[model samples]
Each structure stands twice: as structure tokens, then as C-alpha cells.
Target: MPSPPSRVVAVVVTFNRLDQLKVTVARLLDAARTEGLQRVVVIDNASTDGTAAWLDAQTAAQAADGPLVVHRRATNGGGAAGFETGMRLSAEWFDPDWMLVMDDDARPAPGAITAFHASDRTGAMAWAAAVYFPAGGICDMNRPTLNPFWHRGMVTRTLLGMLRGRGRDGFHLTQHDYDARAYRAVDSGSFVGLFVSRAAIETVGYPDGSLFIYGDDVLYSLAMRQAGGQILFDPAIRFEHDFTTMTDADQRFKPLWKTYYHYRNLLLVYRLASGPWFALVLPLMVAKWTLKVRFHSGERGQYLALLGRAIWHGLIRRTQVDHAQVLEWAEPK
Candidate 1:
């Protein structure tokens, strides 16, 4: 009827990181000219560093070449919020058959967009993702390695613990450099080079804005899988990512109040994905966090203090406002 909204919508969320973000847009535009991407939406969080103005110029230059919508927010909303806003806008305006979520530091190898179309996102195949990480390198595009137990908020916790300081374990967005031979799917990955079909969006909807920060992609991917959407990591498609900005200890990692959302969302994801049985294990998670903070790192006391407050807030109330809110989200797969 209405042309079924281009089958592919590309959305990018950026903040003040103008220099880094420039790379992603250049790649997307290049892909559009060669591989033919139809629609793209970029949401710029209120950036004081002239990012908004620069984007304005970029959009004007590409307006005729591609249908790109650029919107600038009044203030910074964390990556989760920016992504939520971008996804919603992408679905409403461009409504591509497949939505590609790219981050400022991530990208695709040649034909990465084509690999998305080749995944066959029809009837049963609801979710189609690219392969991630080639070798010990940073994350690349993902493969179809769906985790039987897909949990968004927690995927990083596991991967981070394993990837922490592992010498030679370079970082990338898609994580494609890990294993380039086959395609697989795990729980989730950074938003830098994510590809989603319209069918999956119709069923999964936008990522939970309530998350406010981290864990949105993990949660979104889990929803797609539970809805019978297949998460594939096509080896042929390579999305590039430069994910070595900060560390977990960074207060601005998500936001100052990220200590709250990270814990709260962790509980939320575990509850939804794991079920009552898993939810009951929240206490153990808390305990482990406490121990890790104390014994694992010197910030034990501070970690416990902050984590305790977060646990109380998440467990006590249905919703809470975190004073800290800024745009930022990414991780190694």
C-alpha cells in the first residue's frame, strides 16, 4: 500500500563527539551511494561543541542525495534515550523494512548493508543481525549466534568481565574481527552497527526508554528473539567499530546516576528474561556486586554504598528519576 517504508532505515545517535562521529556518517553516506541505502535518521543530543551546527550543514548537503532527517534535542539524553528517540523517529518517518542502528564509532565493511538484506527476515526469521568481532580485535558486525538466554542489561557484565584487560583483545563495534568464518548470534551488541528488519520492529517496538542508559540493545535484542526473530551474524557483512573511549569506572560512562540505572535495569532485564526463578537471584547479584566492588577493586566501599542505594530505589519504587542524564552507550560484544 504505502510502499512499505523502504525495508531499511539507518539511525545514528551522537553527542559532542563530533570528530569521532564524522567517520560513521561518512561511511553511511558512502554505503548509500554504492549499496543504495534509502532512508537514514540522525538524532543529535544537545551538544555544546558545535555538533548540532555541523550536523545541520551535513544534512543540508545530503538532503537531495538521501532522505535523511536530522533532529537536535534541547539537552543530552543518554545513549539509551537517544537510541530510543532515534528508533521511534526512524520507525515513524522513514519506516524502512530494515532499520540499521549505527553509533558514532561503528561502521560496516563493504556490502554490510547487502548482507542484512540477504539474511531473509521473513515469517519465522524475525530478527537478522550481523556477525561481531573477528579475532581478539574489537567488535565487528554480529553473526547469527542467538543466546538461548538473551539478557540485554547483563550481556556486557559477562563479556566485560571476560574481556577486561585481556591483552591483545582489541575492541571493535560489530566484533566481526573475532571469527570471520561463520555467522552466529549472542544476546546483543553495541548500537553502532545494528540491523533490524521492519517485521522485528513491528513486534519488538522501540527500546525501553525507561532504561535511561545502558542495556537497551540487549533488552531489545532479547525481545526480538523471544518474538521468534532470528539474530544472525553474517560473516560476509562487516560493520566496523572503534570502541575504546572510556572504562567502566567512568562516572560519565552512562550518566552520573548510571549507578542507579545500570543496577535497576539489570534487575529489570533479569526479571523479564530470566523469570521469577531468576528474579529471585537478585540478592545474589547484589552480593556479587558488593564483593567485586570491595575485593575486586579498591572502590569496594563506594561501590557498595552506591549499589545499595540503587537496589533500594529499583526494588522499592516502580519508577524513579535519575538526576544524571547524558547521551552515551557502546560496548564490546
Candidate 2:
């Protein structure tokens, strides 16, 4: 007999934030109930705190009803690795057709998954990309333009720009074309929360985890659209997320050297995902970091110096997704 259809697979990747993880888990379970979901996967990125222990107890208690599976990575895989791991395992191992990706801190409003799936079944759309921050966050994830060789072509363009030693600065971002209406096509993906389809996964592959951070989600969504998948931004779902909490955006857990990954990864994405004549934001960002560092970081020109060095590195170094090795900022190993 043919195999049964794949159910909704909710995958959450967590780090040291046990409190946020617990709340996210609770909300996901609630989502399961509301949507009759039966598959759930929680990948703990090796939290040194009580998160792993609590999950162990939950499993032992058998209180995690409705198809719950938890796996603990040996190390923190950062955001991209965590997302890739959870998705790969869920679809490959568990055989779920639909995967709902949630960040450690993202909590969807009631019926968010249900609403997304409802739109998918409409037969007009293929996939649904969920919210990010700034607005309610649970707004929409849209698809980008189509060209057979676009993604790879842009990658070539980036290499050429670097080889020619030209100045281009600005991360890749497409202007919003559609009116802010209920159903519209978009060119961005809110990685914080996204509802992806199995077909999309089969088409786009997984997010690249290298260069450390940023742009994996948007690239994946774009790839899906290129492969004939539709990404919906149903306004029904809502969530909350900020760049950081009481901590300043400029004041991160890591030193300047390692944080350079953001610069590299974003440049990589802009090069791979943007149209011809990609504009690099390195100049503006360098200036911004210079100010933020000169004033906010307390050391004159420390972070600004780091930013300048980062641009040099990004222009030359090549990186790709490495799911096995991850370093979480919250806890040192």
C-alpha cells in the first residue's frame, strides 16, 4: 500500500534559554492540540543548563503527548545549524511532509499553524513563511523573483566583484512590491518563524550554516519559490522577538573577531541572492560600527576596527554550511 500522508512536524531549536524553551514547548504543544498535530521535534543544542534535564523528565513522565521527540546535539549548532538539523532529521528520519520551524524565543498565537496550513490547502499557494520582528512578526513570508540561474549567477557576480577589487556595500534586500494586503507575494523570509512544505524542502535543500549567521531563511524561501513553491504570509499568526534584550545590540556575547561571521555570511547571501550589480552595505555598516564602537563599546574605534577587518575577510574567505560544529553564545563549552 502507498504510505500515508506526512503530518505537521514542529521543530524547535534551543540553546541555553531553558525558560524560553519551556514556554516555546508549551506553545507548540498547544499548537498541536489546536491543529491536531501529531509530530513534534525539539533539538536541544547541548544546553548546559536544566533544559536537557527537564526534557528528559518530560519524556520519562510520558507527559509529552502527541508524538514528541527530543534530540540533544553534542554542541550548539548556532541558528542555521540548529534549524538545518531539526529539519533534516524531522523530514528524513520522522517522514513528515510539512515542517514548522520555530526559534527558541518565538511563540505563535493560537491557531497559527492551523491558519498557515489552511492557506496551503487552498490550492493556490504551495508554502507559508511565517513572521519575524518589528510588526506582530507573525505576518508573512513571500517568494522572490524567478530565473533558472539566479542564485548561482549572483554567487559568480560576488566573486567577480571581489576579484576586480571594487567597492560595493549594502546587504541584499528587495523592495516590497505588493500592497500590504492579506494575500501578496514577498521576497523575504522571516527565519524567526516559518511554515515550510515538504515539496519546498525537496526543492531548495537545507539552509547553509556557515559563515556563522544570517540570510539562510530568505535564501531557502527564494529557492523554494524558484522550484515552484508558493510562500504565504498569512496575517493570522503573530509572535514577538527583538534583536536583543536588556543587552545592547552592539554588546554581544562574543568578541569582535568571531562576530565578524555576520559580516561574512551577509555578504555571502547578498552575493548569492541579489540581482546583478549587487550593492554591499559594508561602507555604511562600517561607519555604523565605527560610531557604535567609538561611543557605545567604550573603547575608541575597537569595534569599528573589527568591522573594517571583517570586510576584508568577507571579500576573500569562502565558507559553507557546517552542521556538525556549532558554538552557542549563551554558554561556553
Candidate 3:
């Protein structure tokens, strides 16, 4: 006798990227026929783009047992909140054994879901997919990494790399890493194509919505690891991220003020991963930020002020995801 299929629900969080969402949904639905993907819940974050209308039309056109379901949020709560909303609704209605989360622009290729389900993740809490850019380059941002602070060899190699001016590049996955045929253990992963078991959610709870964006996935993955849950990166299951533009060296004051959330949430992720060792790591992080601002940014004084504010708030561990506060800092004075 054969084993029964696992019940899986895909939870997609969309903001304003309707075009990408359409492509993602179509591919996911087509893949469902063979992948045991029973349901899909799309959480729309108040998209101004005709996203709501498109969803309504799609839902109406499908059968009563159609896999697609839509949740239209009144306010844009960002990706973290959107994922939380989608997951909660999925559990309530679909009651799936597993849930896969991704952004609107992250599209799983054909057979991606089937490949993921076939992988032997016996006790993993979550599994990350190898994310490549649409043009077939590795999506650097979604590469799963080992926590250097947790492993001695990783820490030593990471220190050497930083001394060689590689910074934290040692922690990120390389092309060779992404092309591996076997499953590899990882400390953290992004939401893009992340599949989480119901047991994992029950153990660690949902991703913190207060993060708004940036590093929420890292924090959640760390929490799962802390709870004795394993996270694996299975390269066989791959997704494409629609990131055509390159912005590697431009992570500073040019954005004027999104740096607040970036650095603040990063600190939160670092603190979560570091535990009692956060005090030891704090000075190094601060010094690095100071140097980056001094050498790279054009608006030195304003950038320093924003960095100081972010560090202070991160120290105090503020959890409020205030869009207004971020916008106030983002606007030019």
C-alpha cells in the first residue's frame, strides 16, 4: 500500500506586485495537481493595483473546491504581518499539515513543489528552497546561511574572511552550495519558498508581525532552531525571484532612510541569534556601522543620527512596527 499525500497549503503575501502574483498563482495551481498542494491563501496588503479585482474574478471563475482563497487586508501591514494573517487563516480554514510561504514575486518553477514534497526531510521544522533570479543567477538575498556564532569552524572561517575584507560574505551560500544534490542543514532562511510544518508552528508560533519587514524570517528561523527544530536547505526545490536590478554596494544613505528598518531589524536578528553573547557582539557591529557611514554615505551627519536612533531602539527591543515613524524619518527634512 502507498502512503497518503500530505496536506499542504501555500500562503502567499502580496503588496502591489499584481503581475508577479498572477504568474505565481497560476504556476502554483498547476503544480498542485501532482504535488498534493490542496489549498492556497493569498493575503493582499491593500494593493492599489487592481489586485483585489483580479483575485475576486479568479475566485468566481473557479469551482467551489478550488484551491485559491483571498484575504484582502484593509491596511498594508508589510510582509511579516501579511504572512501571519495568511497562516492564521490557513490553519483555521484549510487545516493543512504544512504551509509554504513566499512573496508575490517569488515564483516556484514547474515541479518545484513536487520535488520539495519528495525530499526526505524526516524531522525538519522548515525547509528552504534554492532561490535564483529570473535570469538564472543565484538570488544572493535568499541564500540560507549557517550561524557563525553557533559553530566554531564557521566562526573561525568567518573571522578570516572578514580580516580578508570579505566582510560577512563567508556566511552566504555560494553557487556550489546552491547546486548540491543533497539536503544541507542551515541556521536561517528567508520566507521565499519556505515550507513549515504544523508541528513547527505549534512549537515556535508565528513569525513576529511587529518586525514589519527585513529580518523577520531570520528571527523566526532562529527561534525554531532554539526550540530544537531543524531547518534544511534542499537545493532540488528551486524558485525564481524577479530581482533584475543589482543593489549590493548601495546599502547606505542613498535610500535617505529605509536604513532605519534595515539596521534595526538586523540588530534584532543578531540579538536573537547571539543570546547572552549579544553584548560581546554589539561593539563590533556598532564600529562597523560607524565606519560604513563615515566612508560610504554622502549624508554623514543625518545617516549617523538615523543609525544611532536605530541602535538605541534595537537595544531597548522595541517591537512596534510603526509605518508612520519610519515614513517620518524617511522623508527629507
Candidate 4:
């Protein structure tokens, strides 16, 4: 008797970036047709732009050749909720052997998914792609790092590196060398091009939907690590990220609301990852936010207010907030 076919599903969370969505989905569908990809699950976060309609048309047009499972949310619960929904529904709908998660702005290079499957044969529970900017530079934020807290030698070396000011990623907890060989072990990775096994998801469960955006991937990857799962970063699995968001140290408050979510979710991530050690991080976080507010010229009062709210909710473990309320808080009075 022949063995059952291996199943792979790509789960994408998209907001209003319709052009990028179109390009990504097209590439994904092309890959699915040729590269043995089984299906794709797109979670649309109630985009005002015509993202939902475009996805609908794609679903209809490509139903036969390249299968797609698109779920349109009623409200914009942000990327965290979208991933939660997409992953859960992908499991229910396809029960895939592997699920590849990415954002709409992320486009997998040729053979990226293939590289993941090839690396998975080495007994990893999850694998992350080597994400790069569209201009071919490494995407700084998506670099996978080893959890020093999980390894004693790593902890000591990390501390020594920090003391020496060796590199920008002194702690060795947030960034990795992009040139690492295939299947380097890691603790976590971003959603940009992460592949998780069915067994791992079954063991650790879905990501917390309430996170509403930032740090969701970190929290989920840490949870997987805590569950005793192995995560590998496959440099051969390359993906390009069209990240146009602010990357500089401007610290201005134009996109003030996202700052709230970023810090709030970061605090929650630290609390969950460190447990009681979070007490050591809380004061540092407070000092950093305070400094940003003091130095930034844009809307200091509003930034302070948002920072306070973020700290309060993060401390209380309240990750979910209504989208409308967040908008109201973000809007200029």
C-alpha cells in the first residue's frame, strides 16, 4: 500500500496592503501548483481597502487548480488574531502535516517551502526562513536567536558579549547571524516565514489571539520551546519582506497607537518568557518608555497616556482590546 500524501498549508494574515497581497498570493499559488503545496489559508482582518474582495475573486478563480481557504474576519483583530484564526481554521479544514505562516508583505523565495520540508526531516518541530528585505539585505528584526535562558553556556557567553560590546545583538537573544548554515537551532522566529509541524501545534496549542499584534510570534515560539519542541532556522529557506514601516530611531509619535501595542505586547512577552524574572525587566521598560516620551517632540501627553495604559494592561495580563477603542485612543483629540 502507498503512504498518505504529505499535506502543507500556507496561512497568511493580511490587512490593507492589497498590492502586496496580490503579489504574495500569486507567487504562493504558483508555488502551490508546481512545488507540491497543498493549500493556502488567508485571514483577512476586515480591511477597508478591497483586500477581501480581491481574495474572494482569487478564491473563486483558483479553486480548482490551486486551492485556497480564505476567512474574512468581522473586525480587525490585528495580526495576532488573524494568525490564530487562520492556523486554527487551517487545521480544521486541512489538518495539514505542516503549516507555513507569513504576512501579506512577505514573499517566499523559490524553494523556500521545499527547504523547510528538507530541514524538517532532521527532527525539528518548527523551522524559520532566512527573511531578507526586498533590496536583498537581511531583515534585521526577523533574525532567529537562541534563548540564552535555556542554555547555560549561551547565557554566560551572552553576558560576556554584552560586557565586551561585541555586536549590536550583544545578548545573543534577539538576533542571529544570517549566514548560519542550514538548520541552525533557534528558540523563536517571526511569522514572516515560519513553518510549524502539526505535532508541535497539537502539543502547544494555538497562539494567543488576544495579543492583537506585536510579540505574538515571540510569545508563541517561546511557548513552543517551553513545551520542549525544537525550532530550527533554515538559511536555505529564504523570504523577502516588504517592510516599509519605521526602522529608524526617530521615536516620533505619528504612529503613536502602534507604540502602545508594541510595548504592551513586549511586556507581556517578557513576563511570560521570564516568569518571576519579569520584575527585573519591568523597571527597565518603564525607564525606556519614559525616556522616549521625554525626548520625542510629538504629543508627549498622548504618548505618556498610551504608555501608562500599555503598562497597566500588560502588567494585568490583559492583551485583548477592542479595535475601535484602540483607534479612539490613537486618534488626535
TM-scores for the candidates: 0.75, 0.72, 0.93, 0.90
TM-score of 2: 0.72
Model 4, 29-81: lDDT tens digits are: 88787777888788999999999888888877864655777899998899999
lDDT value for model 4: 0.80
- State the weakest 10-residue window (summed lDDT) of model 1: 324-333
Best by TM-score: 3
The Cα error of candidate 2 at residue 246, in Å, is 8.2
> Per-residue lDDT tens digits of candidate 2, residues 235-319?
4455544334324334542543444556556565555554454454445445544555543345334444445545666666656
RMSD of each: 6.7, 7.1, 2.1, 2.7
Q: Is candidate 3 or candidate 4 better by TM-score?
A: 3
Off by over 4 Å in 2: 1-6, 63-66, 121-181, 226-228, 242-258, 279-295, 320-333
Task: Identify the leading candidate in terms of lDDT.
Answer: 3
Candidate 4 differs from the real structure by a C-alpha RMSD in angstroms, to one decimal, of 2.7
Model 4 clash pairs?
none
Query: lDDT at 239 for candidate 2?
Result: 53
> What tens-digit string does per-residue lDDT give for candidate 3 at 1-333?
856667889999998889999999998888776677888899999999999999999999999988899999988888889998998899999788888899999878788888866755657999999999888888888889888888877767876787787756778777787877878899899999898889888999888887777788999898899899999888989898985333666655445566777788999988877778889878988887878775544577667777888898888988585787776766555
Off by over 4 Å in 4: 1-5, 63-65, 119-122, 153-168, 171-176, 249-254
CA shift of 278, model 2, Å:
2.5
lDDT of each: 0.61, 0.59, 0.83, 0.80
- Model with the higher lDDT, candidate 2 or 3: 3
